[model samples]
Target chain A: MTSDRFDLGGGEPIITLRDIAKSYWRETLEIPVLQGIDLEIPAGAYIALMGPSGSGKTTLLNLIAGIDRPTGGSLEVCGHELNGLDDDQLASWRNLHVGFIFQNYNLVPVLNAFENVELPLLITGASRGERRDRVEQALALVNLEDKMKNYPRQLSGGQEQRVAIARAIVTDPDLLVADEPTGALDAKNAEEVLGLMERLNAEFGKTIVMVTHDPKAAHHAKHQIHLEKGVLDKAVEVNR
Target chain B: MRWLALIWKSLMRSKRRTLLIVGSLVLSVFTVAVLQSLLTTLNAVTNNPNSSNRLVVRHKSGLTQMLPRSYEAYLRQQPEIETVCALQWFGGYYQDPRNFFANFASDETTLFQIFREEFGASGISEAQIKEYLRDGAGCIVGESLARKNGWKVGDVVPLTGTIFPINPRLTIRLIFKSPKPSDENALHFHYKVLEEGVPYMKGLSGSFWVRAHRPEDIPRLIERVDRHYANSAYETLTETENAFNLAFVKMLGNIGAIIQGITAAVVVAILIVTGNTMATAIRERTTEIAVFRAMGFSAGRVLVLLLSEGVLLVGVGGFLGVLLVNLAAGGVRSSLGMAMPFFADFAILPDTILACLAGALAIGLLATFVPAYAATRRPITEGLKAVG
Candidate 1:
């Protein structure tokens, strides 16, 4: 394992963070969650964020995904400076550039797998045929094309997570931010999900940033960035 | 339109909750529709177009008061009057008191002449009129009344009078149909039956119905008749037939206001109920809403989706309510017509139906707006942490 300053050295970075700070105000009390974070993640690099609880790992991921606006400093993801964009503009930018995978699988219970995967495309003004093709391709890549009509309730934990992955990748976004992606799955299902993530990173050249506490989950990434008390340490390259 | 499936599925997410809210809306909308239609039906009585050329002459004191039978002769003497018929309320029932209906004793000689548009317009032959006048104990019934009582021509209808205390066994000489439903739910017999059966009522009448020669003659005839008997012992109150019907409606004392007030109250109740229900439903979907927001659904778009779900719910309920009222209108008309002559044509007007649906949509938008907007405004991260 080799540790270095937080930069993957080859192509232009897809995500650039500079002196990023985020704080939530609970009434009059300002609670700082992340402060003065600076990092650059090159395109096609699969990375994991590891930290103890309350270390702002998810908060940093939220900032990178453009779901949360930083209180100070600049965030540029996929070449768009996020700090200058308004909330709705940021949402539109996220729709085009970012995809999200949540820990609990977060599949809308009322929607079947196909509809869940098709959700992100609904806002893109994509033609019906285009959306259907993209959704099918995403599901086929996740190897769950046969379960397109099954609802989340009918799916196993592993299947639901795979469907979530399908949903995240359906739009073919530039960045994928996942928070605790395998937190709820059993060990076998977790291994399967991590293998799928490896395939997404290696075969599809997708830039993946996932937050997890498990060491084995972090090992699936090419590099692991650790955060403690809103500060980022050096990145460690995981040797095969 | 593309989001319709999502909205529909979300609304149907909790089938029991959605159904309960829809049931409440259906009941609320049904109540308002029926009450408004009843008010419209009552108003139609005073706006009847056929009554424009007719005048009613009643005792000056009130409707229940009696005028001298000689007033008919004076009414006929007016140059503007084309025909006159003296009528007395013979409030009667059939075999049972529960079968009560409006029955009147009227001058048979000029009955058809005064109501030619009502009785003759529907193709009643001259022979039928003559037969009714020729028989001493004969009556003319509206087609609906005859059908309701299973009576045909030459059938004997024994009406026991409540006010005059007399039983008149009269043959149905003519069964006439009128365009107005109210007119078709009444029975009219020869006034001579009461005149001879009860001697004291020989020279008294409840009212006189006068037909003017032309529509323009009604106003002048009304003025002239009231002026002629202004200070007499049996002073007369003359008005157009519409005003006469309106006077009866006015006797109910601000009934329209009462219905409107109740309707408004019901609408507010629906809003509160539906608002509370939508709030609960949205609260339960906090994580899902956050998931949608995280998936790049803008706040405004999500709000619209939730509102569409609410409106579709109430819209369906309102449509069913209006449909139910329309389906049951005939039975309601028949039952009310037997009890009150003014409600004989009870119907839910199209305008009322439109108004109900519009009101439902407005309520849907209103009831769901606050909760859905608040849900959208919530921090996506905070919402994502919410449990089911």
Candidate 2:
């Protein structure tokens, strides 16, 4: 077996992990969430992570999204070592390279769909015309061009999640991490959202890493990795 | 643009709360603007250079202490003093005690000479002045007092004296047309009329009103006049018209400071209320702020958006208050009459507006710090997890 500190190349692997460990402190006791995780995600590869409730799936997703730091291992995403980065640097990196989607579809209620999609583009020093163009393209991609001016209160649950997705991908980040993107939706709406994510991965050659408890959602991805009790158990390849 | 949209949305979130805060601000600012305007007008009237040309010389002991009639003759001899008149304060009341006015008894021969600008032949003929001076019991009432008492030019009205302990017997001889708009509330009568009726007035006089060639020469001329009688039995106090008016106002003690303190308290209270409102709004929009941060907005931009909204709200309120004050200025002056100066200076409104804007912005920035920081520091995963 290879050592956990495997490095793919000098600059190719978009994400690299070496014996990453994470824990939650509850009073004096240390409750370990993730233990000894080693991972490598290449550029433009779709990855699906599947696990049960206590499998540290969310914690791993948090680490990959740059929302939390690993405890005992090195994590490198987009050729930047996240272990040594401060909170500000991590936030900047996340803005530049990482996009996040959650089950609840956290959207600003005050802004219309178009403005919401344009939010991430504001921090990138993009010109106003470029921002507008990208926002239009994103809204069009989700087939929400007609509802661009509608506020979140005027949209349905599925449409809101689609808007959130548009906001995430508008900046064209290197990695799109979604934690249960369809958890709040009904079967039909869930299928529609999943279809959109699958199309984005296939048509744009975008890399997507999704954590889900649904087997059907995992079937849509090219590679699926299962975690059980803070450890990777198996990897499966699926033909879409 | 993004920040503006965010602020707009946040304000729109609760229409009732926004309206309440803005409404209260408008009312409070309006009241303050009106009060400040009146105070400014009164202060200007008393401090104006034109208003200081006149002077009042009374007994050194007190205004009630009478001066010798010879003092007036002595003052008239000074070349620096152009004219001198004996003015006796006749403490009297109209039919109703509330209908108060200034009634003064002055030497008829020199009264018109000293107040030539206030009454001229166009309003009161020189023949009538001669006739009033010849008649020892003759009196001239101001137009405002005449109007208030409904006394015509030839009408005779009785006045009761409170200080001289005389029988309730006096009459209005003629009504002098008011020269300036502000001088319509005075009553002037011949001091010789009082001297003839009161038994104790053989050598007693009230005070002297002096007119000087140049306002600047008043102090030196007054020193010369006072030095002439320094060792005499009756010592005198000489003061400019403005100083005399200010001394009377000062008797009330620090009215300006009291008004300033009240104004300061109001401003502080407004800041606290506005700050609390902004804080609550920011807290309610915490998740939305995080969403903006996730979308690439900096914390500074968020703060600017919130602060701009606050300034806008205060600007609107302040403007409304100024408009109201300007509209009511005329009515305020007419109603206050001579008690207070009517229209105050409108120049101060701009500074007040700027102050309100700064105050609003300060509250907004202070309120925004915590929420903006919280949003900036929020984990993208956790923020996305928030349901609302």
Candidate 3:
């Protein structure tokens, strides 16, 4: 039921968080993950969440991706209040609106590149021909159309990451969230992935939120936000 | 439908684990099918379709005690009794104790009329039946028994008696074949040879087999004969041929109970092995499952995928196991037909195969439910953090 209720319309912020807090429990003790966080990411804006390891940058990114719920405060992603939806509803929301890229390039080992890219589309009611065309187009956009039949182990770190990127953008999602997309890659491969992400943001106008500690990786985005100890340190807009 | 391919690929991820679990399931189901089918074949003898209008009169106490031979003439006086035959158990062995079969001393003149349903059919010719009736020292042996000992119609067969007093060397005048396998492994001789050989057996025989005029006359004839001999020196217990065969099965000491116990044990063993393997498999795929949940697959979908793996594994195994039973049935029929007196046919029933398949499916589902549900119920964030 796509209705006016879910319509924040064009040029609106895709993600808006206010006083968001997440915590864990160790018996009776409370371990706070992210507290008193306020952030907004607009449509077609590329941003990086930069922080130390335990700064909860990944947790914050996960919340924005609708993968986790904030224990307190409000979270709105793609015009849907995530806290208002159940776990199942949030999952559907993620499938439609957000694409995920993980640090290790979490492609299913058994599925080849083409099948891996076709996973999200399988959830949709898209016909087989449509899914096939879209998968081929996604792989061609990532410049790995030739490696569509290769399993994950048959490809190198950079090739695997490219296949993962194809999988991420195959759904043509409004938002792409990468949690250290290049952390497991070497210098050359990391440079290739960073360039590809920049091309996706600049050429396609696809929004991206990346979590990484590497300044080199962070520089791929138009805006950089540093988080320290479950708190937002600063947000800076980069030129070029 | 594409999910089916995913399930297949996921199950094939660990080939050694899948093979091991499937192998265990096949072994257990094979053993269960064979055992239960044997029990079913044995139980089927009670209502043997070939035993027509026949009643066996034994001692009121038990089969071992001798009955008066004069009861045959008294039974012949009854209007319902069409014919009577003296059937004394000749517990005999041909060459070895392992080479066992049914050998009885029956009234040669009336034996054909009494058991014509089993013998006078297409398997044995009328000429062979005449040859058996003509010679006093003649014997009728089933075709399977002849093949085992390599005896032809003119061969002189000597069987050393275990329970009776003497050994009888007689010509195998007739080699008869029967439709039933157990019925084909038998030897019947004249009761006079047995009585004349043993002095005390002259006036006493083991039992009497009486054929009535009609199938409906059996119950009334049984009541009449037993009541007539109720307080006599050789008091008789008379019953239908089905009940008579059932008594022999009962003498084997609760075979149905034993079969059920073994089947239950085998099923439990399969459940334990398959359940443990499924638990380990599900544990290893925790992160993958969490990924599916994150990708909008509901918990029920994941459960279906996981449980389908178990079914595909065990269901294929059970099918192969039941197929093995069918393949080996001929050999089983021959071998066990030689060993057991009541096992006429060893076959895998359609019901048995269906039962095996249903049982395997049930075991697969029951084994995977706890593990699949457990994997699905864990928080997606926690599962996503699992490394292996």
Among all windows of ten consecutive residues in candidate 3 chain B, which has the lowest summed lDDT?
A: B120-129
Candidate 3 displacement at residue B374 in angstroms: 1.5
Ranking by DockQ: 1, 3, 2
Interface RMSD in angstroms for candidate 1: 1.7
Tens digits of per-residue lDDT for model 2, B1-388: 4655655666777888888887777776766665565456557656755545678787888877888888877777777778888888787666665555666778777888777776763377777777677666667777756776788765665666777765334456667764444555666677766776787876687788888877888889778877877878998888887777777667757868877777777777776777778677766766666656554455556656666676666666666666766676656655665343222122344665565455545654554455555654666545555655
Best by TM-score: 1
* Candidate 1 displacement at residue A228 in angstroms: 2.2
User: What DockQ does candidate 3 score?
Assistant: 0.48
Retained native contacts per candidate, as fractions?
Answer: 0.54, 0.38, 0.44
Q: Write the per-residue lDDT of candidate 1 for residues B91-121, one digit (tens) a residue.
A: 8888988886788899988888788777766
Candidate 3 lDDT, B134-243, residue by residue in tens: 88788989887888799998899888889986889989998877777688889999888888899988878888998899888888888888899888887899998889
In candidate 2, the second chain superimposes onto the true chain B with a TM-score of 0.76
lDDT, model 2:
0.73
What is the Å distance of residue A15 in model 2 from its true position?
2.0
What is the Cα root-mean-square deviation between model 2 and the actual structure?
5.8
lDDT of 1 at B321: 88
**Residue A117: error of model 3 in Å?**
2.9
lDDT of 3: 0.86
- lDDT at position B200, candidate 2: 89
